[model samples]
Target chain A: MNVFVIGLGLIGGSMALDIKTSNKEANIVGFDANEAHMEEAVSIGFIDRKGTLEDAKEADVVIVSIPVNVSLEVIPKVLDIVKDDTLVFDVGSTKANICTALENHPKRRNFLAAHPIAGTEFSGPKAAIRGLYTGKTNIVCEVEKTAFKLQERGFKIFNDLGMRIRYMDPKAHDKHIAYVSHLSHISSFMLGKTVIEKEKNERDIFDMAGSGFESTVRLAKSSPAMWSPIFEQNKENVIETLEEYIANLQKFKELMQQDDYNAIYKEMADTNRIKEILKGISIKTS
Target chain B: MNVFVIGLGLIGGSMALDIKTSNKEANIVGFDANEAHMEEAVSIGFIDRKGTLEDAKEADVVIVSIPVNVSLEVIPKVLDIVKDDTLVFDVGSTKANICTALENHPKRRNFLAAHPIAGTEFSGPKAAIRGLYTGKTNIVCEVEKTAFKLQERGFKIFNDLGMRIRYMDPKAHDKHIAYVSHLSHISSFMLGKTVIEKEKNERDIFDMAGSGFESTVRLAKSSPAMWSPIFEQNKENVIETLEEYIANLQKFKELMQQDDYNAIYKEMADTNRIKEILKGISIKTS
Candidate 1:
């Protein structure tokens, strides 16, 4: 298979690497508008060659893994250029916008809207790793809209990559992801911003940061390019989640201010049920 | 030297294991209010034997690694029971309350206030591991109030365990930690709560929980017994930090609702400075 992946950053570069590693017959090519990333991806052996959208005509599969905003603009362009047999898919976090953008395209049948629910805070080609999607969930929206053959090809690829597939409507995918994914990035980024603003001394942040701060603020390091459009695309859901999150924090703050230790304990204890919830979904670390 | 650890959970048990591994001459004893933890600590060889408050007086060093509220209640009692020359210290996250509680104790000079800024999300004796505090910062607050000889001993033990020590006033420690440490926990817990409330389906959460969610929500699993008092002790500071955090989130939400993509992008881009701030902290992980 000849695979051409756009935006050779963390997710796309990782997919290319994993595909090549797992399938010896696969010929993986990459492209990035950022020259440094393209060079790094090539040097790191993440791809066999640098390619352009023109090359999509020859590729068996074309992946749009750029930021959501860019993907909305780029997906139709790729669909217009790629061969009818080419299975074009996007691994974007927000689905409704991307799906909406290509809904009227003549080659829409060739496009599969997918979100591989796997990523790290780190970005760029250097952050790419093999098996990033392994054992992770991949949400595919409006699969029936894609040609049956193309949907089958996507299934084969995700299965080969060791990911479980879940089907959801594009609207539901956007709403649920806003709460589970997009809101997390915003909370972490804002937390990092608040702390940095209040504590001007970077040394103090570094010295006093325990595992708690590191864990909670880890998403603050995510690419702004990738996340900004997600919040914009899913603005309503993001706003709802943010309001609830703020309200929750305010409630806890009020409890603390009143010295209602018992209430604070009860609130935290209630939320601690997340241990079981997370364990239910958690990938085995061992 | 004989070392008695008052609490046999993750921190105390891990410390006992590290001390035993590092100092072959140190005989370690542990006691916990929870019998199950005490048994697991002994079974895991975190302690050579189960000891009591009476044994605290016989030890050359006494480590009180309990919940913050329990630490406040127990430190004075432990100080009253320990030998005049015994170096007593509690490794709680908050320092001001514990330090103040023991301020007038007859053995106050023997009690050293320390907060070792290291931990994983896992808790209890089963979570114990060797070298948990290795190369981590051990912040010693109000050390001038400690006897010079006991302070010398406390510094020696931490140094031998591969920890760096920094001194600050207890009040300053509480305020700084509220921002860097306590606030992170509340943010994570609320993040978990918000997501769980939105996505009632635990399977979706597990499927969609990328590394970003895992990192941001990691501290949600922390013990309520442990965190409740830290919030109670540092109530004012925590409330102030939460207000700032909620305000930041609200502002970002407004931008998102207004569809101000550029402002959203700029906000996240500015907060990306946390990448540089985190660099200065001693994160053992790459």
Candidate 2:
């Protein structure tokens, strides 16, 4: 099989590596608007060749792993060029915009909207790793809209990469992802900004940062190019989550300001139930 | 040397294990309000035997690692019982209250107020690990209040645990830690609660929780018992930090609600400087 991965950055480069690792015969070609990323991807052997949109015409699969904004802009172009039977899919963080963008495309049947719920804080071709998707969940939205053969091909690729699959409506997928993923990025970035602004001494952050701060702030290190678009595309849902998050923080602040130890204790205890909820999600700490 | 560790849960238990790991001949004993924890500490080899406050009176070093509120209540009592030469120290998250509680004690000179900036989400004896303090910072507050000989002993133990030391006033330590650590716990807990409330389907959280959510919400898994009192003691500082944090989130939310894409992009782009701040903290993501 020939796989053409556009945007040879972290997710795209990682997918290229994993596909080749799973199938030795798989020929992977990569494309990136960033010349430096393309060079790094090729030098790191993430792709067998550097390819173009013209290459999509011959690909058995075309994976769009660019930023959410770029993915929305590029999906129609990919659908226009790829073979009718080619399994074209996007691994964008937010799905609704891309799904809506391609809803009326003539070759919409060739496209599958997928989001493999996996990533690290790092980005770019250098951040690519082979087994990132293994043991992770892959959410596919509006699967029925895609042709059966393309859906089958997409599932096979996800399965080959050791991911569990689930289906959801595109709108629902974006809403939930805003809470589970997008909000996290915002919280982390804001936290990092808050601490940096308050503590002008960078050495203090370095000396005092424990694993708690590291884990909580990890997504603060994600690429601005990738994340700024995700926050922009999923603006409504992100706004809702942020409002609730801010309200929650404000309530806790009020309790603290009033020296309401009982209320503060109860608030923390109530939220501490996340231990059980997160355990259900396989986020085992011990 | 004889070492008596009060409150043998995660932090104290890990301290015992680390001391033993570094010096096999150091006889370590433990005391805890929970009998099960005392037994678990002994069985896990975190301590040679379970002892009492009376044991602290005779030990060369007395370490109190109870909840912040409990530490404030117990430090003066423990100081009254300990040998005059014993190096008494408490490892509570908040320091100001404990320092104030023991300020007028006859044996106050022996009491060292220290907060080790290290921990995991897990709690209890089973969560104890041998090298938890390695490469972490141990902040010693109000060092001048401790006798020179006792401070020397405290320094030796932290150095043996492979921890760097920093000195600060108790007031400053409480305020700084409220921003860096206490506020993080509250943010994580609230984020978890907001997501749980929004996503009524527990399965969706399980299915969609990627590394981003896992990292951002990890501290929500911390023990409520351990954290509740820290918030209670550091209430003012926590309230102040939370106010600023909520204000920032609210501003971002309003921007998103107004569909100000450029404003949203700029907000994220500005906050993305957290990458540089975190890098300064030596948090290597890739």
TM-score of 1: 0.95
Off by over 4 Å in 2: A201-206, A283-286, B201-203, B280-286
> Per candidate, chain B TM-score?
0.96, 0.96
Q: In angstroms, how far off is A15's CA in candidate 1?
A: 1.4
Residues forming the 10-long window of minimal summed lDDT in candidate 2 chain B: B277-286
lDDT of 2 by residue, A30-61 (tens): 88988888888889998988877788998999
Error of 2 at B50 (Å): 2.1
Compared with the true structure, the alpha-carbon lDDT of candidate 1 equals 0.85
Candidate 2 local lDDT, B30-134, one digit each (tens):
999999999999889889999877898779998898888888777888888888799988888888888888888899899899999888998999999878888
- Write one digit per residue (lDDT tens) for candidate 1, span B1-286: 9999999888888888888877899999888998888888888887999877788889999999988888877888887877788999889988888887887888889989999988887789999887778888999998889999999998988988788998888888888888888889999999988887766653454556666777788888888888887888888888889999999999998887788899999998998988877776635423
TM-score of 2: 0.95
Candidate 1: list runs displaced more than 4 Å: A201-203, A284-286, B201-205, B282-286
Measured with C-alpha atoms, the lDDT of residue A213 in candidate 2 is: 79
